[model samples]
Target: MNELAAQIGVEVEPDYRADESDPAQSRYVFSYTVTVHNRSTREIQLLSRYWKITQGNGKVQEVRGNGVVGKQPAIAAGHSFRYTSRAVLASPVGVMQGSYGCTDLASQEAFEVTIEPFRLATPNQVH
Candidate 1:
């Protein structure tokens, strides 16, 4: 990974939305909060996002789009940007991982910040 990419940290907190899910209908809803840490010296703007979602039933879904939640945010150096999003899976358990395409505000250079795999599961669904 590039130094800028390494310095750009991505952390995720996922929760299963039991109230919004319908297991009998094969609808499992999950909400995830993502925090993007700008540890680099220059301010960066999130340009795009890519997601890989894998369900317990062995189905995979890939999503690619510009910005997150309809906003391309510019995060100052040493600052962080946080956003919450929802994902609906066909099963009670799943995993998600992806990366962000960002650009250095000063240099206009682009890089990718990786998001580590995180689990989305209902209570007691995974031990």
Candidate 2:
């Protein structure tokens, strides 16, 4: 419910796991669940994903992949696809933003669904 673009809806929820993190080594683990909703009239298939991760120290990592969680799901109009993924950062706080490439099933037209920036922070960090 955070952002919607190109007739697609993107929601990102992040959770910080203290049990899996080691602050002394500067390793922070966060799990994020993403939901991609098809808001358009045309049916769409999620083809790929593109992400840009920024660490607290200004480090950036670009990730491009064929599909999410090893699946290319075809979402019907008004339906949605949801998946969870994990990220490891060298800092207590960071950011992630990206887009999903989708194809219109009927017309075979390709378009990008924008995902707004979301924060990855430990429980103690202030917003």
- Quote each prediction's TM-score: 0.97, 0.93
Residue 80 C-alpha lDDT in model 1: 98
List candidate 2 segments past 4 Å from native.
1-5
Worst 10 residues of 2 by lDDT: 1-10
Task: Kindly report which residue pairs in candidate 1 clash with one another.
Answer: none
**Segments in model 1 whose C-alpha atoms lie over 4 Å from true places:** none
Evaluate all candidate structures by whole-model CA lDDT and list the values in order. 0.94, 0.89
- Cα lDDT for residue 22, candidate 2: 99
Identify the candidate with maximal TM-score: 1
* Residue range 49-101, candidate 2, lDDT tens digits: 99999999899999999979999999988998899999999999999999888
Query: What's the lDDT for residue 29 in model 2?
Result: 98
TM-score result, candidate 2 = 0.93
